[model samples]
Target: MESTTTKPDEAATEKPVVTRRLDRVFLELYNVAAFVSRFFKEVLMPPYEGKEIIRQFFEVGYKSLGLISLTGFITGIVFTNQSRPSLAEFGATSWLPSLIAIAIVRALAPLVTALIASGKVGSNIGAELGSMKVTEQIDAMEVSATNPYKFLVVSRVLATTFAIPTLTMYTIFVAMVGAFINVNANEATSFPAFIEQFFGAITYLDVFSSVIKSFVFGFTIGMVGCYKGYHSSKGTEGVGKAANSSVVTSMFLVFIEELLALQIVAALRAV
Candidate 1:
Protein backbone atom coordinates (compact mmCIF):
# COMPACT_ATOMS: atom_id res chain seq x y z
CA MET A 1 0.00 0.00 0.00
CA GLU A 2 3.07 2.25 0.02
CA SER A 3 3.16 5.07 -2.49
CA THR A 4 6.45 5.96 -4.24
CA THR A 5 7.36 8.67 -1.69
CA THR A 6 10.90 8.67 -0.24
CA LYS A 7 11.19 7.32 3.30
CA PRO A 8 10.95 10.08 5.94
CA ASP A 9 14.43 9.29 7.31
CA GLU A 10 15.94 9.67 3.82
CA ALA A 11 15.69 13.45 4.09
CA ALA A 12 18.66 15.23 5.70
CA THR A 13 17.87 16.28 9.28
CA GLU A 14 20.89 18.55 9.77
CA LYS A 15 20.94 22.19 8.81
CA PRO A 16 24.15 23.91 7.77
CA VAL A 17 25.24 25.52 11.07
CA VAL A 18 26.79 28.79 9.83
CA THR A 19 23.76 29.57 7.68
CA ARG A 20 21.41 29.29 10.67
CA ARG A 21 23.50 31.00 13.39
CA LEU A 22 22.36 34.44 12.27
CA ASP A 23 18.74 33.40 12.67
CA ARG A 24 19.36 31.25 15.73
CA VAL A 25 21.06 33.87 17.88
CA PHE A 26 21.97 37.29 16.53
CA LEU A 27 18.90 38.08 14.48
CA GLU A 28 16.68 36.57 17.11
CA LEU A 29 17.97 38.97 19.73
CA TYR A 30 17.75 41.86 17.26
CA ASN A 31 14.22 40.91 16.29
CA VAL A 32 13.17 40.71 19.92
CA ALA A 33 14.62 44.13 20.69
CA ALA A 34 12.93 45.54 17.61
CA PHE A 35 9.60 44.00 18.61
CA VAL A 36 9.80 45.57 22.07
CA SER A 37 10.70 48.92 20.55
CA ARG A 38 7.83 48.68 18.13
CA PHE A 39 5.49 47.84 20.95
CA PHE A 40 6.37 51.05 22.79
CA LYS A 41 6.06 52.99 19.56
CA GLU A 42 2.54 51.75 18.90
CA VAL A 43 1.28 51.41 22.48
CA LEU A 44 0.48 55.10 22.80
CA MET A 45 -1.09 55.33 19.36
CA PRO A 46 -4.82 55.66 18.74
CA PRO A 47 -7.40 52.85 18.61
CA TYR A 48 -6.13 51.39 21.85
CA GLU A 49 -6.84 47.77 22.73
CA GLY A 50 -8.03 48.51 26.24
CA LYS A 51 -10.13 45.40 26.72
CA GLU A 52 -7.45 43.01 25.59
CA ILE A 53 -4.95 44.75 27.82
CA ILE A 54 -7.25 44.28 30.79
CA ARG A 55 -7.65 40.61 30.05
CA GLN A 56 -3.90 40.28 29.86
CA PHE A 57 -3.58 42.27 33.09
CA PHE A 58 -5.75 39.80 34.91
CA GLU A 59 -4.07 36.79 33.41
CA VAL A 60 -0.53 37.97 34.08
CA GLY A 61 -0.98 39.87 37.35
CA TYR A 62 -3.91 38.68 39.38
CA LYS A 63 -3.34 35.05 38.51
CA SER A 64 0.18 35.13 39.88
CA LEU A 65 -0.87 36.76 43.16
CA GLY A 66 -1.44 33.50 45.03
CA LEU A 67 1.98 32.12 44.23
CA ILE A 68 3.58 35.32 45.45
CA SER A 69 1.60 35.24 48.68
CA LEU A 70 2.41 31.61 49.44
CA THR A 71 6.08 32.16 48.76
CA GLY A 72 6.06 35.30 50.90
CA PHE A 73 4.52 33.37 53.76
CA ILE A 74 7.19 30.69 53.68
CA THR A 75 10.00 33.20 53.21
CA GLY A 76 8.86 35.22 56.21
CA ILE A 77 8.57 32.25 58.53
CA VAL A 78 11.85 30.60 57.57
CA PHE A 79 13.86 33.82 57.47
CA THR A 80 12.70 34.80 60.95
CA ASN A 81 13.33 31.33 62.41
CA GLN A 82 16.84 31.27 60.98
CA SER A 83 17.73 34.82 62.02
CA ARG A 84 15.97 35.04 65.39
CA PRO A 85 18.61 33.00 67.21
CA SER A 86 21.40 35.37 66.18
CA LEU A 87 19.40 38.46 67.16
CA ALA A 88 18.37 36.65 70.37
CA GLU A 89 22.03 36.05 71.20
CA PHE A 90 22.39 39.81 71.10
CA GLY A 91 19.28 40.11 73.33
CA ALA A 92 17.63 41.82 70.38
CA THR A 93 14.99 39.19 69.73
CA SER A 94 12.76 42.24 70.10
CA TRP A 95 14.10 43.48 66.77
CA LEU A 96 12.65 40.50 64.83
CA PRO A 97 9.67 42.28 63.26
CA SER A 98 11.61 45.46 62.55
CA LEU A 99 14.50 43.66 60.88
CA ILE A 100 12.29 41.31 58.89
CA ALA A 101 10.06 44.14 57.67
CA ILE A 102 12.95 46.27 56.42
CA ALA A 103 14.59 43.42 54.54
CA ILE A 104 11.35 42.02 53.16
CA VAL A 105 9.86 45.35 52.17
CA ARG A 106 12.98 46.88 50.69
CA ALA A 107 14.51 43.92 48.88
CA LEU A 108 14.08 40.24 49.64
CA ALA A 109 10.37 39.78 48.91
CA PRO A 110 10.32 41.74 45.66
CA LEU A 111 13.53 40.20 44.33
CA VAL A 112 12.62 36.64 45.24
CA THR A 113 9.09 37.06 43.96
CA ALA A 114 10.42 38.35 40.66
CA LEU A 115 12.83 35.42 40.44
CA ILE A 116 9.96 33.00 40.98
CA ALA A 117 7.74 35.00 38.65
CA SER A 118 10.33 34.69 35.91
CA GLY A 119 10.35 30.92 36.26
CA LYS A 120 6.55 30.87 36.10
CA VAL A 121 5.30 33.76 33.96
CA GLY A 122 8.37 34.28 31.81
CA SER A 123 8.49 30.67 30.65
CA ASN A 124 4.74 30.68 30.13
CA ILE A 125 4.99 33.75 27.92
CA GLY A 126 7.80 32.19 25.90
CA ALA A 127 6.14 28.83 25.44
CA GLU A 128 2.80 30.40 24.61
CA LEU A 129 4.24 32.71 21.98
CA GLY A 130 6.60 30.05 20.64
CA SER A 131 3.64 27.72 20.25
CA MET A 132 1.63 30.41 18.48
CA LYS A 133 4.52 31.09 16.11
CA VAL A 134 4.92 27.40 15.46
CA THR A 135 1.18 26.99 14.83
CA GLU A 136 1.10 29.89 12.33
CA GLN A 137 -1.21 31.95 14.50
CA ILE A 138 0.93 35.08 14.27
CA ASP A 139 1.02 34.74 10.49
CA ALA A 140 -2.72 34.19 10.41
CA MET A 141 -3.26 37.32 12.51
CA GLU A 142 -1.25 39.31 10.01
CA VAL A 143 -3.35 37.94 7.18
CA SER A 144 -6.47 38.95 9.09
CA ALA A 145 -5.26 42.58 9.24
CA THR A 146 -4.15 42.45 12.84
CA ASN A 147 -0.86 43.98 13.94
CA PRO A 148 0.29 40.85 15.67
CA TYR A 149 3.13 42.62 17.41
CA LYS A 150 0.88 45.27 18.92
CA PHE A 151 -1.94 42.90 19.66
CA LEU A 152 0.30 40.34 21.26
CA VAL A 153 3.35 42.09 22.64
CA VAL A 154 2.02 45.41 23.85
CA SER A 155 -0.78 44.11 26.02
CA ARG A 156 1.42 41.51 27.65
CA VAL A 157 4.28 43.92 28.20
CA LEU A 158 2.05 46.60 29.65
CA ALA A 159 0.40 44.00 31.85
CA THR A 160 3.76 43.03 33.27
CA THR A 161 4.71 46.66 33.75
CA PHE A 162 1.62 47.30 35.83
CA ALA A 163 1.04 43.95 37.50
CA ILE A 164 4.47 43.17 38.90
CA PRO A 165 4.66 46.21 41.15
CA THR A 166 1.21 45.33 42.35
CA LEU A 167 2.54 41.86 43.12
CA THR A 168 5.56 43.39 44.85
CA MET A 169 3.30 45.51 46.99
CA TYR A 170 1.28 42.44 47.86
CA THR A 171 4.38 40.41 48.58
CA ILE A 172 5.66 42.99 51.04
CA PHE A 173 2.34 43.08 52.83
CA VAL A 174 1.97 39.30 53.09
CA ALA A 175 5.53 38.84 54.25
CA MET A 176 5.05 41.22 57.17
CA VAL A 177 1.85 39.45 58.09
CA GLY A 178 3.64 36.09 58.03
CA ALA A 179 6.47 37.53 60.08
CA PHE A 180 3.90 38.48 62.68
CA ILE A 181 3.04 34.82 62.91
CA ASN A 182 6.73 34.11 63.47
CA VAL A 183 7.00 36.79 66.18
CA ASN A 184 4.10 35.15 68.00
CA ALA A 185 5.61 31.70 67.59
CA ASN A 186 7.95 32.44 70.48
CA GLU A 187 6.15 35.18 72.41
CA ALA A 188 3.65 37.79 71.26
CA THR A 189 5.21 41.06 70.20
CA SER A 190 3.20 44.29 70.63
CA PHE A 191 1.35 44.63 67.31
CA PRO A 192 1.21 48.46 67.42
CA ALA A 193 4.89 49.01 68.29
CA PHE A 194 5.90 46.33 65.77
CA ILE A 195 3.85 48.03 63.06
CA GLU A 196 5.24 51.45 63.92
CA GLN A 197 8.85 50.23 63.97
CA PHE A 198 8.42 48.41 60.64
CA PHE A 199 6.90 51.49 59.03
CA GLY A 200 9.69 53.65 60.52
CA ALA A 201 12.25 51.65 58.55
CA ILE A 202 10.32 52.33 55.34
CA THR A 203 10.87 55.91 54.24
CA TYR A 204 8.67 57.14 51.40
CA LEU A 205 11.89 57.45 49.42
CA ASP A 206 12.72 53.79 49.89
CA VAL A 207 9.22 52.74 48.96
CA PHE A 208 9.24 54.91 45.84
CA SER A 209 12.59 53.63 44.57
CA SER A 210 11.81 50.03 45.40
CA VAL A 211 8.49 50.21 43.60
CA ILE A 212 10.01 51.87 40.54
CA LYS A 213 12.76 49.25 40.29
CA SER A 214 10.18 46.47 40.44
CA PHE A 215 8.35 47.98 37.50
CA VAL A 216 11.57 48.00 35.53
CA PHE A 217 12.18 44.40 36.54
CA GLY A 218 8.72 43.43 35.35
CA PHE A 219 9.13 45.21 32.02
CA THR A 220 12.45 43.53 31.33
CA ILE A 221 11.06 40.11 32.19
CA GLY A 222 8.05 40.51 29.88
CA MET A 223 10.15 41.85 27.04
CA VAL A 224 12.65 38.97 27.13
CA GLY A 225 10.02 36.25 27.36
CA CYS A 226 7.74 37.67 24.70
CA TYR A 227 10.61 38.42 22.37
CA LYS A 228 11.97 34.88 22.43
CA GLY A 229 8.58 33.26 22.07
CA TYR A 230 7.32 35.51 19.29
CA HIS A 231 10.34 34.71 17.17
CA SER A 232 10.80 31.03 17.90
CA SER A 233 11.86 28.79 15.02
CA LYS A 234 12.16 25.05 14.23
CA GLY A 235 8.88 24.01 15.84
CA THR A 236 8.87 22.16 19.21
CA GLU A 237 12.62 22.25 19.72
CA GLY A 238 12.68 25.99 19.17
CA VAL A 239 9.77 26.54 21.54
CA GLY A 240 11.59 24.60 24.25
CA LYS A 241 14.73 26.62 23.70
CA ALA A 242 12.79 29.88 23.86
CA ALA A 243 11.18 28.92 27.16
CA ASN A 244 14.47 27.86 28.69
CA SER A 245 16.26 30.99 27.52
CA SER A 246 13.48 33.27 28.73
CA VAL A 247 13.68 31.96 32.32
CA VAL A 248 17.47 32.08 32.32
CA THR A 249 17.61 35.62 30.99
CA SER A 250 14.90 36.92 33.29
CA MET A 251 16.53 35.41 36.39
CA PHE A 252 19.87 36.99 35.49
CA LEU A 253 18.27 40.36 34.91
CA VAL A 254 16.39 40.18 38.21
CA PHE A 255 19.62 39.72 40.13
CA ILE A 256 21.39 42.51 38.27
CA GLU A 257 18.51 44.85 38.92
CA GLU A 258 18.67 43.90 42.61
CA LEU A 259 22.33 44.81 42.83
CA LEU A 260 21.69 48.09 41.07
CA ALA A 261 18.68 48.86 43.21
CA LEU A 262 20.56 48.08 46.41
CA GLN A 263 23.32 50.48 45.41
CA ILE A 264 20.75 53.14 44.66
CA VAL A 265 19.04 52.50 47.96
CA ALA A 266 22.35 52.85 49.76
CA ALA A 267 23.15 56.09 47.99
CA LEU A 268 19.70 57.42 48.76
CA ARG A 269 20.13 56.45 52.41
CA ALA A 270 23.45 58.29 52.62
CA VAL A 271 21.76 61.38 51.21
Candidate 2:
Protein backbone atom coordinates (compact mmCIF):
# COMPACT_ATOMS: atom_id res chain seq x y z
CA MET A 1 0.00 0.00 0.00
CA GLU A 2 1.22 3.46 -0.88
CA SER A 3 0.55 6.61 1.16
CA THR A 4 -0.52 9.63 -0.98
CA THR A 5 -0.92 12.08 1.86
CA THR A 6 1.25 15.22 1.85
CA LYS A 7 3.37 16.09 4.86
CA PRO A 8 2.30 18.99 7.11
CA ASP A 9 5.59 20.87 6.58
CA GLU A 10 5.40 20.40 2.82
CA ALA A 11 1.82 21.72 2.76
CA ALA A 12 2.82 24.72 4.84
CA THR A 13 5.68 25.52 2.54
CA GLU A 14 3.62 25.03 -0.63
CA LYS A 15 0.83 27.26 0.68
CA PRO A 16 3.18 30.15 1.35
CA VAL A 17 4.88 30.14 -2.04
CA VAL A 18 2.15 32.06 -3.84
CA THR A 19 1.68 34.35 -0.89
CA ARG A 20 5.39 34.99 -0.69
CA ARG A 21 5.51 35.77 -4.40
CA LEU A 22 2.68 38.27 -4.05
CA ASP A 23 4.45 39.90 -1.14
CA ARG A 24 7.63 40.17 -3.15
CA VAL A 25 5.73 41.72 -6.04
CA PHE A 26 4.12 44.31 -3.80
CA LEU A 27 7.45 45.06 -2.19
CA GLU A 28 9.04 45.59 -5.60
CA LEU A 29 6.23 47.90 -6.67
CA TYR A 30 6.67 49.97 -3.56
CA ASN A 31 10.41 50.19 -4.04
CA VAL A 32 10.10 51.24 -7.67
CA ALA A 33 7.57 53.92 -6.76
CA ALA A 34 9.96 55.20 -4.09
CA PHE A 35 12.83 55.27 -6.56
CA VAL A 36 10.82 57.34 -9.03
CA SER A 37 9.69 59.71 -6.28
CA ARG A 38 13.26 60.31 -5.24
CA PHE A 39 14.24 61.01 -8.84
CA PHE A 40 11.64 63.72 -9.08
CA LYS A 41 12.61 65.22 -5.71
CA GLU A 42 16.33 65.23 -6.44
CA VAL A 43 15.90 66.40 -10.03
CA LEU A 44 14.45 69.67 -8.80
CA MET A 45 16.58 70.21 -5.68
CA PRO A 46 20.03 69.94 -7.15
CA PRO A 47 23.27 71.36 -8.32
CA TYR A 48 22.15 70.33 -11.77
CA GLU A 49 24.43 67.76 -13.39
CA GLY A 50 24.23 69.61 -16.67
CA LYS A 51 27.49 68.36 -18.20
CA GLU A 52 26.77 64.75 -17.36
CA ILE A 53 23.26 65.07 -18.70
CA ILE A 54 24.59 66.54 -21.94
CA ARG A 55 27.07 63.71 -22.25
CA GLN A 56 24.31 61.15 -21.72
CA PHE A 57 22.15 62.99 -24.24
CA PHE A 58 24.86 62.45 -26.84
CA GLU A 59 25.34 58.86 -25.77
CA VAL A 60 21.67 57.97 -25.72
CA GLY A 61 20.25 60.20 -28.47
CA TYR A 62 22.83 61.02 -31.10
CA LYS A 63 24.33 57.57 -30.98
CA SER A 64 20.90 56.00 -31.51
CA LEU A 65 20.08 58.14 -34.55
CA GLY A 66 21.29 55.70 -37.21
CA LEU A 67 19.50 52.71 -35.75
CA ILE A 68 16.26 54.62 -35.20
CA SER A 69 16.28 56.09 -38.66
CA LEU A 70 16.91 52.74 -40.29
CA THR A 71 14.11 51.19 -38.31
CA GLY A 72 11.78 54.02 -39.26
CA PHE A 73 12.64 53.63 -42.92
CA ILE A 74 11.98 49.92 -42.97
CA THR A 75 8.77 50.29 -41.03
CA GLY A 76 7.54 52.94 -43.45
CA ILE A 77 8.08 50.80 -46.50
CA VAL A 78 6.56 47.69 -44.96
CA PHE A 79 3.52 49.43 -43.53
CA THR A 80 2.83 51.21 -46.81
CA ASN A 81 3.42 48.08 -48.85
CA GLN A 82 0.83 46.22 -46.81
CA SER A 83 -1.60 49.06 -46.38
CA ARG A 84 -1.58 50.63 -49.82
CA PRO A 85 -2.85 47.52 -51.57
CA SER A 86 -5.91 47.24 -49.32
CA LEU A 87 -6.52 50.95 -49.51
CA ALA A 88 -6.18 50.91 -53.30
CA GLU A 89 -8.84 48.22 -53.55
CA PHE A 90 -11.20 50.61 -51.86
CA GLY A 91 -10.17 53.40 -54.24
CA ALA A 92 -8.85 55.14 -51.13
CA THR A 93 -5.16 54.97 -51.99
CA SER A 94 -5.10 58.75 -51.79
CA TRP A 95 -5.54 58.45 -48.04
CA LEU A 96 -2.34 56.42 -47.57
CA PRO A 97 -0.14 59.26 -46.41
CA SER A 98 -2.63 60.54 -43.83
CA LEU A 99 -3.47 57.11 -42.63
CA ILE A 100 0.17 56.13 -42.27
CA ALA A 101 0.99 59.45 -40.66
CA ILE A 102 -1.75 59.04 -38.06
CA ALA A 103 -0.78 55.47 -37.33
CA ILE A 104 2.92 56.30 -37.03
CA VAL A 105 2.43 59.39 -34.87
CA ARG A 106 -0.20 57.78 -32.67
CA ALA A 107 1.38 54.41 -31.98
CA LEU A 108 4.00 52.77 -34.16
CA ALA A 109 6.83 55.27 -33.72
CA PRO A 110 6.45 55.53 -29.97
CA LEU A 111 6.28 51.78 -29.41
CA VAL A 112 9.14 51.00 -31.78
CA THR A 113 11.39 53.74 -30.44
CA ALA A 114 10.74 52.74 -26.83
CA LEU A 115 11.33 49.07 -27.54
CA ILE A 116 14.57 49.86 -29.34
CA ALA A 117 15.73 52.09 -26.54
CA SER A 118 14.84 49.40 -24.06
CA GLY A 119 17.13 46.96 -25.80
CA LYS A 120 19.97 49.38 -26.50
CA VAL A 121 19.97 52.24 -24.02
CA GLY A 122 18.33 50.30 -21.20
CA SER A 123 20.77 47.42 -21.45
CA ASN A 124 23.72 49.80 -21.70
CA ILE A 125 22.73 51.71 -18.57
CA GLY A 126 22.02 48.53 -16.65
CA ALA A 127 25.29 46.90 -17.63
CA GLU A 128 27.37 50.00 -17.01
CA LEU A 129 25.91 50.60 -13.58
CA GLY A 130 25.83 46.93 -12.70
CA SER A 131 29.53 46.71 -13.47
CA MET A 132 30.17 49.82 -11.41
CA LYS A 133 28.19 48.36 -8.50
CA VAL A 134 30.04 45.08 -8.86
CA THR A 135 33.47 46.79 -8.91
CA GLU A 136 32.57 48.97 -5.88
CA GLN A 137 32.95 52.16 -7.91
CA ILE A 138 29.62 53.46 -6.65
CA ASP A 139 30.78 52.95 -3.06
CA ALA A 140 34.04 54.72 -3.79
CA MET A 141 32.12 57.62 -5.40
CA GLU A 142 29.95 57.89 -2.32
CA VAL A 143 33.01 57.89 -0.03
CA SER A 144 34.44 60.63 -2.19
CA ALA A 145 31.19 62.65 -1.69
CA THR A 146 30.44 62.74 -5.41
CA ASN A 147 26.70 61.88 -5.22
CA PRO A 148 26.77 58.85 -7.51
CA TYR A 149 23.01 58.63 -7.79
CA LYS A 150 22.83 62.13 -9.23
CA PHE A 151 25.84 61.73 -11.46
CA LEU A 152 24.65 58.38 -12.74
CA VAL A 153 20.90 57.85 -12.36
CA VAL A 154 19.53 61.37 -12.61
CA SER A 155 21.68 62.35 -15.56
CA ARG A 156 20.85 59.24 -17.55
CA VAL A 157 17.14 59.37 -16.76
CA LEU A 158 16.79 63.05 -17.63
CA ALA A 159 18.79 62.57 -20.79
CA THR A 160 16.55 59.69 -21.80
CA THR A 161 13.42 61.68 -20.94
CA PHE A 162 14.46 64.58 -23.15
CA ALA A 163 16.09 62.50 -25.83
CA ILE A 164 13.12 60.22 -26.61
CA PRO A 165 10.87 63.04 -27.76
CA THR A 166 13.53 64.28 -30.12
CA LEU A 167 14.10 60.75 -31.33
CA THR A 168 10.38 60.20 -31.81
CA MET A 169 10.11 63.36 -33.89
CA TYR A 170 13.05 62.30 -36.02
CA THR A 171 11.61 58.81 -36.41
CA ILE A 172 8.35 60.18 -37.71
CA PHE A 173 10.13 62.44 -40.15
CA VAL A 174 12.38 59.68 -41.52
CA ALA A 175 9.51 57.23 -41.65
CA MET A 176 7.58 59.74 -43.70
CA VAL A 177 10.51 60.05 -46.05
CA GLY A 178 10.52 56.32 -46.62
CA ALA A 179 6.79 56.30 -47.12
CA PHE A 180 7.07 59.09 -49.66
CA ILE A 181 9.74 57.23 -51.56
CA ASN A 182 7.55 54.13 -51.67
CA VAL A 183 4.55 56.14 -52.78
CA ASN A 184 6.56 57.77 -55.54
CA ALA A 185 7.97 54.48 -56.67
CA ASN A 186 4.62 52.67 -56.70
CA GLU A 187 1.93 55.33 -57.24
CA ALA A 188 4.04 58.18 -58.63
CA THR A 189 2.93 60.78 -56.09
CA SER A 190 5.26 63.77 -56.08
CA PHE A 191 7.43 64.28 -53.02
CA PRO A 192 6.05 67.77 -52.50
CA ALA A 193 2.48 66.48 -52.66
CA PHE A 194 3.18 63.72 -50.19
CA ILE A 195 4.92 66.12 -47.85
CA GLU A 196 2.04 68.59 -48.03
CA GLN A 197 -0.57 65.94 -47.28
CA PHE A 198 1.49 64.39 -44.51
CA PHE A 199 1.86 67.62 -42.57
CA GLY A 200 -1.73 68.53 -43.27
CA ALA A 201 -2.93 65.28 -41.74
CA ILE A 202 -1.03 65.91 -38.52
CA THR A 203 -2.70 67.99 -35.81
CA TYR A 204 -1.53 69.78 -32.70
CA LEU A 205 -3.17 67.16 -30.51
CA ASP A 206 -1.39 64.34 -32.31
CA VAL A 207 2.01 65.95 -31.82
CA PHE A 208 1.36 66.82 -28.21
CA SER A 209 0.07 63.36 -27.31
CA SER A 210 2.95 61.64 -29.07
CA VAL A 211 5.49 63.79 -27.24
CA ILE A 212 3.83 63.06 -23.91
CA LYS A 213 3.91 59.31 -24.56
CA SER A 214 7.62 59.47 -25.49
CA PHE A 215 8.43 61.16 -22.17
CA VAL A 216 6.67 58.46 -20.19
CA PHE A 217 8.22 55.62 -22.23
CA GLY A 218 11.68 57.13 -21.92
CA PHE A 219 11.31 57.58 -18.18
CA THR A 220 10.18 53.99 -17.75
CA ILE A 221 13.17 52.68 -19.71
CA GLY A 222 15.65 54.74 -17.71
CA MET A 223 14.07 54.01 -14.33
CA VAL A 224 13.88 50.25 -14.84
CA GLY A 225 17.49 50.10 -16.04
CA CYS A 226 18.77 52.26 -13.20
CA TYR A 227 16.73 50.40 -10.59
CA LYS A 228 17.80 46.96 -11.76
CA GLY A 229 21.44 48.00 -12.04
CA TYR A 230 21.49 49.80 -8.74
CA HIS A 231 20.20 46.73 -6.88
CA SER A 232 22.04 44.04 -8.85
CA SER A 233 23.95 41.37 -6.89
CA LYS A 234 25.71 38.01 -7.33
CA GLY A 235 28.62 39.55 -9.24
CA THR A 236 29.02 38.95 -13.01
CA GLU A 237 25.88 36.88 -13.22
CA GLY A 238 24.04 39.77 -11.62
CA VAL A 239 25.16 42.24 -14.25
CA GLY A 240 23.79 40.03 -17.01
CA LYS A 241 20.61 39.49 -15.07
CA ALA A 242 20.15 43.21 -14.47
CA ALA A 243 20.61 44.09 -18.13
CA ASN A 244 18.20 41.35 -19.20
CA SER A 245 15.69 42.42 -16.59
CA SER A 246 15.95 46.06 -17.60
CA VAL A 247 15.03 45.35 -21.22
CA VAL A 248 12.20 42.96 -20.36
CA THR A 249 10.76 45.13 -17.62
CA SER A 250 11.03 48.32 -19.61
CA MET A 251 9.31 46.68 -22.58
CA PHE A 252 6.50 45.35 -20.37
CA LEU A 253 6.02 48.76 -18.79
CA VAL A 254 6.06 50.46 -22.18
CA PHE A 255 3.21 48.25 -23.41
CA ILE A 256 1.21 48.93 -20.25
CA GLU A 257 1.86 52.65 -20.58
CA GLU A 258 0.79 52.54 -24.23
CA LEU A 259 -2.54 51.03 -23.31
CA LEU A 260 -3.07 53.62 -20.60
CA ALA A 261 -2.05 56.42 -22.93
CA LEU A 262 -4.52 55.21 -25.54
CA GLN A 263 -7.32 55.23 -23.02
CA ILE A 264 -6.41 58.69 -21.84
CA VAL A 265 -6.17 59.98 -25.40
CA ALA A 266 -9.54 58.47 -26.26
CA ALA A 267 -11.10 60.08 -23.23
CA LEU A 268 -9.62 63.41 -24.14
CA ARG A 269 -10.76 63.13 -27.75
CA ALA A 270 -14.25 62.24 -26.59
CA VAL A 271 -14.34 65.31 -24.37
Question: Best lDDT goes to which candidate?
Answer: 2
Alpha-carbon local distance difference test for all models: 0.85, 0.92
Q: Each prediction's TM-score against the native?
A: 0.88, 0.93
Tens digits of per-residue lDDT for model 1, 42-89: 899866878888998898888898888899888888888888999989
- Which consecutive 10 residues in model 2 have the weakest lDDT in total? 6-15
Show where candidate 1 strays beyond 4 Å.
Answer: 1-29
* Residues 110-185, model 2: lDDT tens digits: 8889999999999999999999999999999999989898999999999999999899999998888889899899
TM-score of 2: 0.93
lDDT of 1: 0.85
Error of 2 at 208 (Å): 0.5
